[model samples]
Target chain A: MVLDLLASGLIYSSIIVLGSIGLSLVYSIANFANFAHGDTMTVGAYAALVTFGAVGGLGGTVLGLPYGFFVALGVGIGMAALVAVVTEKFIYEGMDVGSIGLLITSIGIAFIYRAIIQMGFGADFTRYDIPAMRPIDALVTYGIRVTLQDVAIVASATVLVVGLHLLLQYTDLGRKMRAMADNPDLARVSGIRTDRVKLWTWIIGAGLAGAGGVFLGLFSRLTPRMGFDLLLIIFAAVILGGIGSVYGAMLGGVLIGMTTQLTPILSELGAVLPLVPDTWGIPIGIEYANAIAFVIMVAVLLVRPSGIAGEVV
Target chain B: MSLRAIVDDPNAYWSGLTRAEQGVSGFIAGFVVLLLGGLFTGILAPTYFLFLVGIAGMYSLLSLGLNVQWGYTGLINFSVAAFFGIGAYGTALASASSSPVAGNLAPAVGLFVALVLAAILALLIGIPTLRLRADYLAIASIGLAEVVRIVILNEDQLTNGSAGVRGIPTFFDGWPLLDTFPQTMPSVAVSWLPSGTVVLGQSFWSALLNVVVVVSFIAVSYFVLKRAHRSPWGRVLRTIRSDEDLARALGKNTYRYKMQAFVLGSLIMALAGVFYAHLNLFVSPGDLSPITTFYVWVAVMLGGSGSNRGALFGGFVIVAIREGTRFLNAFEFIPFDVAPLRLLLIGVIIVLLMRFRPEGVLPPQRELIWPSVVDDAPEQPDSGVRDSKAGESND
Candidate 1:
């Protein structure tokens, strides 16, 4: 049972990691919390959904996902990037208000994005046109019931996250971006074109969020509110890992995801584990999973406001 | 800006107002006239109009609460709905006949309990987040709201679960004459040429009483807020908002002041929720949605962050948007769901309002000196720079 939960947690963590990296990136670079980031994920998911529906499965499958789905995923990433760039250029760039003002504006932008999506695709749950797959026969024998698609999600997320790591550590743009996020004014004084770096940050951040959204849709079903519903958890992960720290966000995502999936077994674990007596258990329902995550977030804020990987205040 | 000035030199007082202030007065005058015209012509049923007024008053109360937090102290509380819901559910559980936890208590008890609940919640959330950056509060508050909602949704025995607590009595339920006042009132009908005869019955009377209650709540809140906004305490809050470092350097406890503002704002929001529970006759987990929080946020921002009167104006505008979109379904030409349409309007308004006038339509004009001091001073300082000299300076 533990192994099965771990496998599912791995899948869930991939999606959260994708989302938190982007949010942390944006927070560090843009210098404002983008409330609209969740809706940006929604936009990516729907865009991919539309693309997948239009381009059939194209007659082949990889890891239980159609080739057309991968095409759709790429399109999703591109569209999310494009939309963020446009929003930055037209709406955010012209505004003179400080970060707080931008934060408020982002809430408005969030509403607009969600409203438009709801208008276009009626507020209903939808899924990509793919056949459902059962747990792999070999994995089920070991109580690790993960499907090929789950493997695919984890693999794709790994590729994207590692690619981001390389780009941030090795490339010139990455160095420039990191320097700009560290201190925009100092980077500007040092002759870096901050605007260009800021734009690239939005592209990469939003692009990763897009990938997360697509994977999330594949993991479950799609709805207008899916991204929004997941936003709080993603935020928890981002904060736990320490906002603006990419590595921290990844660690936070894994821990949060595992906790969420393992919630149902908490009472059982308490009773069975060595540290606890037989009758001592927290008999909480699975529905309180989100609540637990939020509680954990608040606790983290109280215990260590800077987050695990964040610089000490 | 003072009643004495208007009374002493009416013409000078009127002339002294800025064009924007004059425009606002004119707009308000026209709106009141329009509402009255609609009533006489039977375009609006008296009870429905009263209900609309009650809702507007509720929003105004909510906006006022948020103004105290965001306007005065620059704290971004995204848990407005949670506190509002606490006030609602706290009261509903105490008083609702269907409440599985407790039932049939006096509404006054509910009100007191609800406010206390809201205060506690404010502290619980504020203690952790208020000491952090503004954005952290925003994120944490949003999380707090979600947690409250989840608890409400899953705690079936305590809250009646998703089925909701029903059979909530009116606020005057246990009072003597006021308890049965609606049923005791006689029905009246007035004939109007345009729409037909309008009948005012027990429903109308009850709704009228709700309007009265909400209006009084609004009046008391407005008065208190106005006083606080012009006091030395309010000045410290405003100082914290503009420059926390400066305030801290001066030896003020910024965290304590922020906590007070957050708690005060949360209590007011709870009052609004208590009113809503009584007026709507039910309470549900749906009442705690994040959308409600954003709606209040828009109202506060659009009303001019720190301006109480602007918050009031923003309140009525919210009711218009909420109800106005429902009217679109009657037209048959608008081929869209009203929900998304309302959202679109709110989004567009927020974006446009921020883009054109981030300071809002009626930004706070007066300097934050104590009212008595301003009155007692021998010479008046130049108020023009603070009020009318520049548009972006205040922001």
Candidate 2:
């Protein structure tokens, strides 16, 4: 039972970590909470669907393995990046506004994107054309079942995080980006091109958001409102990890993912545990799972507003 | 001024008029719209359209509540719908039968309890969150609202769960006015009206009563808020909004002031919710979605945030747009669903407005004129006038 919980928790955390990285990066550099990041993830999933349709025969299995999934993933990431860049250039960059204005604009952008998705796709759940993979029972001796798709998600997430770390540490562009995030005016004074850094920020942040969306879609069915559903959870993760730290976002995502998955089991166990009465069980069903993120976020803010790794404002 | 001059340059037209002249013009314009809308819908359209107007009045009250928090105090509250839901469910449960799940109280008592509950809820939420930065407060409040909604959705016995509570007693069901006023009245129809003749019936009377109740709510709240806005208390709120640090430096106890504003605004929202519940004669979780909160935000932004009159006007405009689109939806030529399109247009409008005119249609009045010369002390820089001026330029 514990193994099953851990497997599901890991799957959920993989997607959350991907999404939170972008959110935290944007908050750090852009100096505003981008409410539309979740929708951008939805955009990525839809982009993958479009790509799969456009390249039908090419998506067929090769050597008894699905090779087309990789193509779709690349397309999803690129298309999501394009969407983010376009929005930045057209909407965000044109406005010389305050953080509040930016925040409001992000909300407007969220509405526009979600509405467009609804218009184009209708309010129906969709899925990728990729074939479903069977669970590899031989990999584990325990009763817990882990699917090949789950493995893919974990592997891809690990690779992405490592790649991100390498890029931030070893690359000049990454250093410039970090410098700007730390202090934009100082970085500019030190001859860093803040505009170019901002562009890269959107690209990298949105690329990861798109990847997260694709993974989430693989885990479940795709709906127009999927991004909105996951929005608060992503916010909780970003806020928990600290607003500006990528490493914090990763840790926060895993923690939130585990909490959301395990809380119900822990509450159910109250019935069997001798320490408490059977009636001491939590009355709230799993419907409260989404709300757990919010409760944690509020509690965290009250106790420590800067987040675990965030500097005091 | 000539009509052409007024039409050519509205800013100049507004500038040319005295404050009293502007006030009279605004009142006349509002009266004309109400009269025409009432007559047109009462005669031509079904009674349902008038119902929409009454709902608009409720929304206006919500916008006014939001204006006090977001506009006057610059506090971000994404949880208006939660307070609204509380007022609705509280009133419904209080006035309901004494079942195993709920209480049975009088409607008046229910309203009072809802108000108190909303105030207490606001105080609790504000105590923890108000000390944080604006965005943190925004995140926390939105989360708090979601938590409330989840609880309401799951606690079936108490709130009737997703099925919601029905058979809610209307405010006027046993009122003296219902007995005193005749249910039907003969009326002449205009030549342009679809119906050549008209007879106002029971539904019309009920609708009229609701309109009166809602309009009175708006008027009383408006006058009260306006008075508060012009008072020293209002000045302090504005100062807090413009520069919290300055207000704190002056020993204003900014936290306490903010908490008061939050509680007062939430109580007002709860009152609006009571009106909503009684008018609709039902309460449901579906009625208190985040979208409703966003709708109020749109109204507040469109009308002008800091201005009470602007909030009212914004509410009216949103209702007009919503009903107008629904009316348009009957036509067969439109290719796509009108609802999503309307929302998209609203989003675009908001983006454009934020980029171009964040101050809204009615910019907040920078100064209030008094006949007495001694009133000048309140308008000085010590009140954070310079900060507001800088904010305007930034916009």
Candidate 3:
């Protein structure tokens, strides 16, 4: 049972981390919490759902193509890019005038976007209606079953993370991002067009955010407030990992995901030896699971306000 | 008329006024503006206008309370919803102690008590958290608000969990006290009107009673804020907002000031919640949500910063726009489904105002200056000659 929950946590972590990475990136370089990020993830998941419905019939033994996954990615990435571009052009352009103003603007955009989505999607749940998720052997070996979707999610996330590492470390554009983040004014004065760098920042940030959104849909049923569910925790992760550090965001996401489920896991911690309520519960308590990320965020801030990864921004 | 008098000397306008003077000024100004706004609404229907006026007054109270903290002290209080919920739950618990049956419920002395208690809750949360800078505070407060909701949701014994505590009572013509208040204020016969008695409130005047109670509370808040802001204490608070380190170095005890700001701001928020609960006569956990904070934020932000008048003005604008949406919806020019857009508009205003006119629609004059070069400059210094040539990537 413990292993099952742990495996589930890992899968949860992957989906959340993807979404969180964008939030972390946006906060670090853009210099404000992009409150709309949760909606962006929701939109991405919606895009994936649309794609599945539109293209799942393309192939198999009798039905053969199997191209829906790629379709989902395209839709997700495209939706994210749209939000990124529109947000930059319409919302964020004038925001640098004030951080608090920008934050509020993001909130507005989030509400607007979420409302639009609700109008279209009808504030109900959406899913693939696919077969049961098959747990992988690795997850099973850990005494917890990993579903097929989980394996697929982990594999893609790993590749994406690796790809992100290469993009940040090896690419010239990546280096420029690093430069811009380090000091936007300096980078602009030194010859790198900071505007162009920031533009790429949006593209990359939104793209990753979209990618994470797809993972979220795969792990659980999509609902109107799915993004909201993860929003605070993602914010906590971004802050925990150190704002702007993709790696920190990922670390924070995973840590947070684990802790959220950990309380319930602890509730069953070996009968008489259970630490909480005869059930191995969270280090804090139950019901607080929803609030776990926030507590961590506050604690981390008191100790290291700059965040765990030491802020690359 | 008086606003015109103050407008001429806008810079020295608010702070220089004495507390009694400020209180009277604020009250008269508030009554006039609200009366005017409501009169317009009332032209269509008096009942509707009174409702609009009362709601606007309550919302203004909430926003003004927010203004004191965020506007005056530069504290980002995302947990206004939490305090609001706390007060509401306090009211609910107090009134419903007897049972779920509505009329049988006990009187709500606790509602009045909860306003102050809620402030203590705010202080408890704010003391440890407000020490951080803006971004951290934003994150922290969001978390605190969530904690509040979750606590309300889980504390089934107290809050009744998500099912929510319901059937709370209002401060009323209905309360038994109505019978007693008339006895105290009394009807008096004047020499000029020997045939009739000039009375404060008729025996059955619950509306009059509610108005009196609300007005008194508003006056107290106005007085306390006016006194504090004009005092040596107020100067210290404003100074801390501009530069905390400087305030600390000057021995102002910045922590206490922030605590005071948080506590006071939260107390006002709670008071507003209490009034709001009574005005609505129902208390449920849903009454408080994060959106509540942002709404108050809209009020405070749209209202000018560090200026109570601005805060009040901002509150008026937010409530007007929100309530006005319904009027516009009646015109059918815009779909009423666009009710959600009201929030979107607030967000737009928040973003745009922060970017272009952060002082709000009625911000202080000095805030209209060019965006500070020093304010958002790169963290590290750019060696002079280097800035002229071109931009370099920092990493």
Q: Lowest summed lDDT over 10 consecutive residues: which window, candidate 3 chain A? A: A57-66
Docking class of 1: medium
**Candidate achieving the largest DockQ:** 1
lDDT of 2 by residue, A1-313 (tens): 6677788899999999999999999998988989889999999998887877776646455422356666777888988899999999999998987888888888888889888887788778998866677667684667567787788888888999999999999999989988988899999999999998999999999999999999999889799889878888999998888999888899999999988876676566667577887667665567888788899999898888778888888
Q: Residue A185 in model 1: shift from native, Å? A: 2.9
In model 3 chain B, the worst 10-residue window by lDDT is: B97-106
Q: Of the true contacts between chains A and B, what fraction does model 2 have?
A: 0.62
Candidate 2 docking class = medium
Note the Cα lDDT for every prediction shown: 0.89, 0.82, 0.72
TM-score of 1: 0.94
Q: Considering lDDT, which of the candidate structures 2 and 3 is the better prediction for this target? A: 2
Model 2: runs farther than 4 Å from truth? A57-65, A131-134, A139-141, A269-284, B1-46, B97-100, B179-192, B197-199, B368-395
* Count of residue pairs whose backbone atoms collide, per candidate: 0, 0, 32
Q: Assess each model's interface with DockQ, reporting 2 decimals per model.
A: 0.66, 0.63, 0.33
